[model samples]
Target: MKVNRFQVNVILGIANGIISALQTLWFIPYIKSFLGNEAYGYVSVINGLVNTLMIISVSVGVMSTRFIVVNLEQGNKKKASHYYSTEFFSLLIIGLLISILGIILSFNLRKVMNISSGYYNDVQILFLMTLFSFLIQLISAPFSASFYVKNSLFITYLIFICDYLSRIMMTIFLFSNGEKVIWSSALATDLVYLGMILIYYIYTRKNLPELILSKSLFKIKYLWDVMRSGLWVGISYAGNVMLSSLTTYFSNIFCGVIITGIYSAIMQLNIIENTVLSVLISSILPKMFKLYSNDDNQSLYNYVIDSMILTTLFIGLISSGIVVYGSDFMSLWMGKEFVKYRLLIVLTVIYLPFTLPSQVINQVFTVKNKVAIPAIATLLFGMLNVFLIIIFTKWLNLGIYGIAISAVIVQVLRDNIFYPLYLKNIINRVKWKLSIPFLIGVVYMALGISICFLVKKVIVPNTILSFSLSVIVSGILLFLLALTLYRKKEHLGG
Candidate 1:
């Protein structure tokens, strides 16, 4: 059987995610060896700052993809080109403004984050370099959307892999040649983004010739049209950043750079897991947009439910493995010191089943252009998360664990309860019993964790080889168990 474009996209996306994740995992130890853990903490904060600032750019990119895909699907090439041009020019202006803001913020980073005097100057320079890279990325966001418009997501993933590889090689080369500074990593990133932007522009011009970059195509009306949707999207992105990335900043404020570095290290696993899962889900967005455009509500509903199940299943399986074997893996990878923070790893990932499936619902809101309430809800809950983190850390003295706990509580409230109920209102034609899928996800995760824990007790994998074998065995068993449970549920429904 020949695989279709969707299958190809999923496969390539997973490959890209895996490669990118491995590169990150490797860089953690490598960077720690050279920059030391304290510098690593500062680097994490700088990255978080840059990512937080990029919310507008990401929102514009998202809305551009949605509008371009919808119009292209409807055979309105001119409308699509208008959106493309508007997104490009709008980001160009926004990117410059944000770059200035980022520079000013870079000066004050020492005040907010507990950066030591020794690394402050180097960290400031690194922040500036990273900010410049973000400017390039912001401007190139529209060019990247062309891949989505053409349903060639694999090309995007391929470019991402290439970018990651080049960054790795450049960082290695720089460090080997007696340039083992944190700013060097930022320089590598800067060069890679510059190269990737050229690739994106060339691809868009060659393949999506209709989307020409002309001053005439840039319309204020189109920009307003995008912002009508993109504003809420940007709010949602801000909320998400507050929930996830700001944890590093908070960790620094409450616990100091050493503890912050440890927390950031553990959170990397969670980040990689979420990125991989999101990549898989994103492979379906063009299809989702097409389905919604066609007014195939039933098919759209089916697609949503199917994506939720698959996403939940993958999260369950992967999270269970992490909860069970994470300590051992970290011990082997990062040394024996990390074994003590196994609880942090568990706290980082346990809420995934409750939260991540809601990403599918988020995409639904985007396609339907009904994001106002959800965006507000997300922003409010995100603020609540910040408040709770402060209370838990400062008043209650829970330290970094308090940050993790705050995330869990807020995510369950927003993603599990609020998002589903709100989605019900938007897609009101069908009685969406959203709880069942969440319930099933909880059950699957609980079962997998229990079984894997038991298996771990029996097989104590000390060496890397034994750990690898155990992971393989347990993974297969869990997959089989999940398959059985899913089939049984299908049979009962049938």
Candidate 2:
């Protein structure tokens, strides 16, 4: 795999991801001071709904990327170019409709959530941002994929960095002047994102040869082909978004806004752990796509196995630390009062080891155009999330931990069920299982937790330092266990 535009894209991607993560980290103080916990909860719920719609817009782009990649692989630059333009125009139509629908749905979003108090205006403002954000996302997607085909990751990242920086500057500038600014900041961020996207659209138009809008570009045959390939991907993506983000709304409804705000901070920190791990794993897609494009099954197979092992190990150690010392991290990051919600933070921390595999496997099916299997998986996972959340939250009176627990439960189910099924669907030649290595991963988690308890016993004379030390010890043990269990053997390379 030649390092080209795609590698640049990956770098830019990591940069953008880092900036976004840092900006999110910085949001903690703003969240605590600008409004009540309910206000943070209010923003969370609106953000989730916006994400749900954003996922819907994303389905088209995700499919377009897959479709365009195949055309490029078959050496059909003409078809590939046409597909990009056609998809862009199609998204424009859908973008307009989505903006209208989102605007109309804004009132309903607030009504259904039944939010009251100083947040009503904030919620209204959030819905408007959703409308604009959705449009930007949909319109920019195809151009984003043009870079993907050529493997131009850096510029792809620059697009996001520019957008994110604008968002950050707005938030900082507003907050510095002592404004009530969460909603306003979000609005500014989305508008900046819109501007960055338009730049990409214009750039792609000028730079990419053979890109032109034509009546033939919109032919039914091409449209059918793209949709057929992407049919399952679109559905599952929608379900996954709902499942992943719906917890915010649930947290708000069941746990109170303040709790939601704290949970948001914890969740952000948890994602930071994953983001640090993401630095290692983020290169898989472009490289894997190139391997697959060249029909290099051997390298693809090796890359897949190695990726699973690396992701599992990296996330395992970090998750162990979070599950143990997250209270201290939260105390240090947010405040002491927020430490009461330690269980919520630990719940998110415990699950990432298992969760990262499902993410890897999703990319597998995506590149292969076998979207249906994963879509079904997401459906089952979403249903699982809802059912468990309902049973635990309402029937068992579980509170905030219910949402966290439900997430882990659904992730475990998705990893076990959908992964192998998608492998068979995509190639019909690969054999896979969940037997030994995965079980060892489970044991690794158990040991980390068990050791954490023992360390707690020894350090019990001093609670804070004890938990902190236990977390550190868990990290060391995980590193050794990972070395012993997850052997690096140049596994699965094309």
> Residues 1-494, candidate 1, lDDT per residue (tens digit)?
99988888889888888888788788888988877777677778888888889888877878887888788788898998899889888998898889789878988986677878778888889889989988988888888666666778898788778877876887789889998777776787788788889988999999878776887999989988889888998899889888888889999988888998888878877977797677867787878988988989878987887777777877788889999998888888777999989899999998897689888988899998887888889889889999999999999999999999999999999988898888888787435445656877888988899888777777778888878878887899889977876676564331
- Which stretch of 10 consecutive residues in model 2 shows the poorest summed lDDT? 485-494
* Candidate number achieving the greatest TM-score relative to the actual structure: 1
Clashing pairs in 1: none
Model 2 scores a TM of: 0.85
The lDDT, on a scale of 0 to 1, for candidate 1 is 0.83
Clashes of 2: 18
**Candidate 2 lDDT tens digits, 308-367:** 666676677667666766777677656688678877777887777776765676687778
Span of 10 residues, lowest total lDDT, candidate 1: 485-494
| Predicted candidate 2, C-alpha RMSD | 4.0
Alpha-carbon shift of residue 356 in model 1 (angstroms): 0.2
- Please give each candidate's TM-score: 0.96, 0.85
